[model samples]
Target: MDALTAEEADPVADEHGAHQRGGGPGRRPSDAQAVVPPGALSPAERDRSWSRLGDEDFDVVVIGGGVTGAGVALDAATRGLRVALVEARDLASGTSSRSSKLFHGGLRYLEQLEFGLVREALRERELMLTRLAPHLVKPVSFLYPLSHRVWERPYTAAGLLLYDTMGGARSVPGQKHLTRAGALRLFPALRRDALIGGIRYYDAQSDDARHTMTLARTAAQYGAVVRTSTQVTGFVREADRVAGVHVRDVESGAETSVTANVVINCAGVWTDELQRLSGSRGRFRVEASKGVHIVVPRDRIVAESGLILRTEKSVLFVIPWRNHWIIGTTDTEWNLDLAHPAATRADIDYILEHVNSVLATPLTHDDIEGVYAGLRPLLAGESEDTSKLSREHAVARPAPGLIAIAGGKYTTYRVMAADAVDAAAADLPNRIPASITDKVPLLGADGYHALVNQADQLAARHGLHPYRVRHLLDRYGSLVHQVLAEAADDPELLKPVPGSPDYLQVEIVYAASHEGALHLEDVLTRRTRISIEYPHRGVESAEAAARLMGRVLGWDDETAREEVRVYVARVEAERDSQTEPDDQTADARRAAAPEARPRLEATA
Candidate 1:
């Protein structure tokens, strides 16, 4: 290989025998210890960042604030590059937030003999669960139900043995083959006739949106200027190569020019659109594959471990959430709206029909508490089937100073980002360092286990329940104290939101104060997941939560009421849109909801 890819890059074979990833072969270099500021993104911080975007030049400006873009920003910044990460909407507002929420080696890929992809994903999963993000990515087990008797067990076991050993997957427990009775015991929801036995394997899951937001915060802590609700309108082209970006603050409608040595497009499903704007014919085409998921009560499926049922097209996962069972994902072609991908009645019914095949008591539409839809950016290959397209990503320098990355799973975003920066290496002034992100932990990941151990004491000190403190520790890690401190003077901040009791009022406040939530939609949808978790889809909690956020965002009474009204309308629109039969109808219904920040739509 001339120059190996990020995933294929060999670790240095030093005397210490350290197998560190993503440096040139046999290279182990030390990064300078730079003093980083607090990773807090208050309203004041957002203001300062917007002003800086107008005045300063950076080595790299990463477009898109999803996990991939955030990862790229962190990678470049840690290498001593002045980085700026901009997002048109909230972080993870697109595909990143709406996922099956698993960080695992793709099991189905084994059938395709994509051993290398599985190994890479599994290694990345181990890194996340053990070193990188213990606080976010946690171990989750899934049972693969066996239909056939004799050959099935051996065949599945062989694949699993490879899964266990190939990537050195040790952080989580290994695979275990269980008897029929044992499998039923672990997952009572499984039908006795559905299978003869099962294979239990350990993987990991996370709140994808939360994990992405944490990545942005972690990048900010490492001196990357992170700004959301900032849209890149056009490229600042000088002669042949791209020089910078023409940007607009979506919230305030203020236009600015930001000079950067290189521009990275990590704009997931919108990759083609950005490429069109750049007037560059990209190396590959990105097809938007729609995936729709439904959230039902946890009792609907009486399973201790999640179930992975084999579908004709793609796999269906009945994953376990806190109080709900998230069963979904229908992979079909979607040529609809990119921003708000609506789940039609057909999509919802398809999932219910398939999942109900094995359940003793089938879940009705009434059991559904939430509905969400997200698009996958699949690289269009020779096959027309989106599911048949490759999950492997490609990086291209279609132009001199622009690098675009698309078609990777959420589990391997770090590697994707590292490759993107490496593509931009030529434009950078100095020799950029290799990716140290594998060595550097996310902000809340370091002291998370210790915080969990002290959850009981923390609850007593804060006058809250141990369960609540444990929840806080998982969400904020060591920053739990800073979050709880906001509730010190005002005890009401400890009170739960009206419709969604799962989230506290302080979390809503903190979303605005520290999480860069510019609008009520950001709070309910991404920051807290109240929109999907609650039956009313955040309609009941919108007013109360908006009122709390108003205090932090300096919204007057009228603005608060307007925010509530807009959020309620958005919920109504979404619910109504779900009843539509096709993408065209659904898209029109979803677009009826007014944007939280009107200036954003106007400027666009």
Candidate 2:
């Protein structure tokens, strides 16, 4: 290429040998480690993490990189414990990235009388809104349309009153009652006869994948070794006690043993599988519930706020995403593929049927720009309905030195992490300090509010639009400068990606270099969300994004071409799978494509 980006200038090459470009075909420049942002999960950082995993003894070894696993790593590291986190895939590659992207107290949980779960989640939401992740977590208003004229208003009002009393109303506005005409005025898309009145309330939403990745980065900053694409093959045992794990690098298929006092499995749906691999029985069995969501243009829903409707089995939400409306979430048991959960024709029809019940302009499959499915790891219960399973998390020391934590919502991940680490205290040699993650703001959280206030000035300085600056600030927080600075080598990087105007070219490069994106799918899907946000499903920008990512990760012509081909195949498979009638057929079609990580072994 022409010149090396800041993060690409590191001399260290990861185990895959992608970064060894000294006097080679596409040589760039010397080391510029100073330009690399703090807590950046660059290729060099991955190399360092691999070395640490093999050489150092850890107090805690966490097996997973979802929100909860990242949270545990952050909690353990902040408490001065020697910690290392390993993931089979990329960070937030599973359900963590595929969530409905809300940080609110579960309003639906109130009907089940789960007071403690709702209260704890509301507290976390407030912390994220005001103190912890103000840039990422944002306030969003929702309208609950009243169907029945008589008792519905009083019932919803009473429930919302309790919701507000339990810390849900802070940082955001409380509930507001409105007449049918007033509700119609606020949301013109709603049918006149759909409801008699409405109640509006506020909650918080986030980019779940970005939040989880940032958690891992923050954990790395606090002295935790975080490595992705490293799968735990088997457990390392010492007589009657579980001691450590044998992990294989999925990319290179290289094996290494990591010794630890305790191993915490936050593997989500893969919890039971990990327990089986460890030759131990878990305290609770985890059942996978598949939730499917569809994305459409923002204009499709003519509402300033989102909508929450009651379904026969569960509640349905038409949540507002940027430039799009994310309508979702059919909860059903999933016993198929855990890696790539497929959304079927039935699921899409169900969501459309429920959402269209209220909308004046009903949505068709043609209106959907994207479809995604995620699996929630619920604790198995007597009830067959997955929606009825409790969201409360459970932790257990299945073996002497192995701790498994499962069954929690995304909003309460920090609390879950604290609890998991606290469970490991008995096995740890030293008395571990209590969790201080609540007080520790993420890496980019500090000075975020100040930066938001200076958006215009920063935009002027960077030769960009004020709106673009604001968008970057919301996504990167104070690290907006770190992102924008990558354009110093090539001013063209400041321009937006082809076909995807919402994201800049530099952001794709940053994902590969600073955000631990090993594949083009990672950048397009999780890092920037271009895949689900656009009609072309990122195919329009696949080649361009791959080229941008290749520059930072040092991919040659052939490697870049292969990456594009794989991503295109995956997208096509997803589209084809969506047409399938049921889960089995959908999964078969979805699993037909080649995996980005070619050597990644199946968890089974």
Candidate 3:
């Protein structure tokens, strides 16, 4: 079917009706009245959220949908505050989606004597693994190769010992020393001369995009008005004090004003731009540092555990992604477009050279499946080196009733959010409760362990393999049933996407029906890793995924075709950009690609 029948569309109206019943001016829809999942950010919910944003007065209005902004919304809502979060693009469409995907304590930061920052991040990491998002975040082992035989082992071991103890890590195993033979046995892909020995240590990894989206959804469950494709144009100020914001819908090109007691800016790399728009002096300047990562097939590298190597500039990680290996990250200053950070040929070559130096069978350009680049919002420092800039975030009241927060690592987003909300509390009329997000498990986190244990039975019931069920369980946790339930009417939905076998068609439908996926790029790149995991970079599966999404979003055949066309163009543009030698040329090539949300670039 091209579209969902009336019966299927009934749930969409019911979801909106449920919100209308209690989600009045300052109130939220209670769980008892919600016919749909409370966390569902469907297109219907997006409209409702926008309507509420235009009509109601909020205690806090968050500008940005990245991890920190989503975190702020969750922190505020959980503390009994009426909140609204508006994003220019889809959630985690920025730096949040394009991270190293590691929840580490920043082992390099220790050398810089950032002990407090390391401790804070490690604590947050432990929380994610144990209490917060065990389904999405799990223990990942990394082999830190010791090049020098003598002092390196003791030195690295000491740092790791501090790392293990600082966070009160209990769920994951601690560091273990290994001989050169043992290290080689663990990862046969590595060159024997690459290391004298290795120290294996436990850290955490997650789908950063999914985790950030889940954060926004969890906030929605708590009655936060979370809406994407809404761009902030200017501040709504009453004389000197900031009262709210004037926003424009990127999809419709409609303008509206949202009134709030406090407007928290979590714009990340665009912090200065937003500040300029608000006509306020920013407390601290933000410097954009571009980090690029390359993906290759799992078979390219023979490893049981991930590998961490020291580069001349910074540390390079060979992360073990499911069915693939994720190796990256070149840290260089980016002065071009913030919306689309492009990776140059030099960045890719730099990564390949560093990683290939140790790999027994060096990876070639043809082996690369995908390449992505993201900009980190660093607190600008006196040092010329972007790597030297601190990841520690700063919150400032640049103007009355306005607060801006920027510069922090992904691992410590919760803490950064709590601080932002704490700052917003001062501007709020009523006293708010302290942030309880540390205790609040994100949606799908509650019964994740139980679902993991029941994976085999679920597979049997669904007439699928045990591994498939386990994969769904990891991706959706207790909500795996909901994802599978979409395939009820059409059993074909249970099958994999045409070229992207890793993800099922039902996932594309569910992404639009439940998660807030407004565009094909959002689903291909952020909601699922098809764009990065597959060699085709989602182009092969775009049409099928778009049609599936159209069935849920009520798109016509032409619109679905347009989505496919834009997505293919995007992949091509990225490929073209990667061939460029420098940032300026790459930026032009990448920026030339047609946007999924065309109005976003036009309006911004």
Candidate 4:
């Protein structure tokens, strides 16, 4: 079964004269030549993208490409507004990709008495599981350890009962109480003395980066002009109101002014920065909170179910991620580089000390395969304590034609996006409908369930094992067929990439073609799990991955080697930084490597 050739892969034109297969516009002269094929972006296509932005005046311009920004673009475009979304980097390059990978109702939020947030998140979780992205979000169980014997069960059960009543509880099983012996049966990795009993509750998980990227792609299909490597330099103001923005194409260093009726700032941690750029007095400030997580091999932990335990400062999770266990997540206030937040030795030690207290066999630094640190953009309040700061989001229009949204959990990104778009519409000339994204499914979501049912046939057709095909389907949804077509001419693409055991060569090629992976690091760290799954953090596999990417990205030998060197240094610096005692020291060590080319530079 060979992959589809270029000519065979072109999308058919429908009666409306739109290319039904590719993601682009329709019914316009410019739309006819703007079609982009899956699995790669051509230089001509890139140039056309910039030209289209200049040729048309968008009704709304969305800044940022995280989940929230992607959601805003989708909402605005579907509402019949001419929209454009600009990202300084690739989609989900920040906190969106660095989350614990959960699509949960946040049972812990219940403890904070954030009933509204929990209920809203649960409803969104259900929507993702059943309608929006059944392929991306799935149910997973968590074991909550009960240290105290008698009072634990009743107290936990009461909370679980409330959680079940929240919207979309039917998507997963109800919570179950387990005695000490029973709990041990499910998680023998825990020491006998660690807990008296446990309560198992259901929640959901997802591939956050992939889900976010799909949101942007789906918005593009709906007529939103979406481009990465485009930086919002400043706001375009007309007297007292912000009319649009001045943007620079990072790839070509070309500057252009985009005129829109309204502008939405969904920059996440950089929310306040964008506000400052506009010279607008923002209603609220954004504080960066650092969270770090470590990935270790699954064989080191003998747990059938993921574990959620209470720590002195925050909760800890030992999650099952493919062939590894994802652990840690220290939350502390940070005022450092927003691009890369490094984890210190004390941070890692805090997690190991707490988790090892429960594990029968403890883990050490050498056991870690991957380390990632991300900054959460929390809305600033009067409180000096970062943990007590609000997780609820805010939508503010300090200046006319500009809307800024910040401070929300990953699970509630849709609500944040909808609100941002709704606010932007208030400044538009025409009456815009309320957001319909709640019922909207992302790209590849419509036929996901049906494809899952025919995984066997799909696997055989692609010359892949049934399990392998199932994995791809789960990740790509109905897009799996498109990816498999890439390798139709070369059967060997079906085989796994030599150094990266979890991914196939074809997937890497597909990442360059369809997923907007412009650089080697993008492919390794975000497009796939190679960065976190391998012991060397993709250093060993960098050359092979780079070669595969070069074929698509047109990288010369010198450029390929430079990319590999930069990636290797980044991993080394990250490993070295983790040994430091605090944020200041860790950041200094991490900064030893050459800085990643600015997001604008990569796209240019």
The better candidate by TM-score, 1 or 2, is 2
User: What range of 10 consecutive residues in model 3 has the weakest lDDT sum?
Assistant: 20-29
User: In order, what lDDT does every prediction score?
Assistant: 0.83, 0.87, 0.87, 0.81
State the displacement of the C-alpha of residue 507, model 3, in Å, after optimal TM-score superposition: 0.3
Candidate 2, 62: how far from true, in Å? 0.4
244 in model 2: Cα distance from truth in Å? Answer: 1.0
In the range 1-604, model 4's lDDT, one tens digit per residue, is 3433443443432121332222222122432344445322333345556887777788999999999999999898878889888988778889999999998887778888888888888889889888999988999889999998677788889889989879766888899989899999999999999999899988899988888888887777677777888888888889999998999876567899999999998999998789888998788889999988899999999989999989888699999888899996889999887877899988888889889999999999899888898889888743333222234888887788988888898898888888787777669999988889988887778767877888888787777888998889888887776688667666777889878877888888778766777777888888887888899788888998888777666778898898898889998998889889989989899878874454353221
Ranking by TM-score: 2, 3, 4, 1
Pairs clashing within candidate 1 = none
Task: Show how many residue pairs clash in every candidate, following the order shown.
Answer: 0, 0, 0, 12
On residues 58-106, what C-alpha lDDT tens digit does candidate 3 reach at each position?
A: 9999999999999999999899888999999999999999999999899
Total clashes in model 3, counting residue pairs 3 or more apart in sequence or in different chains = 0
Candidate 2 segments exceeding 4 Å error:
1-35, 381-391
Identify the leading candidate in terms of TM-score: 2
lDDT of 4: 0.81
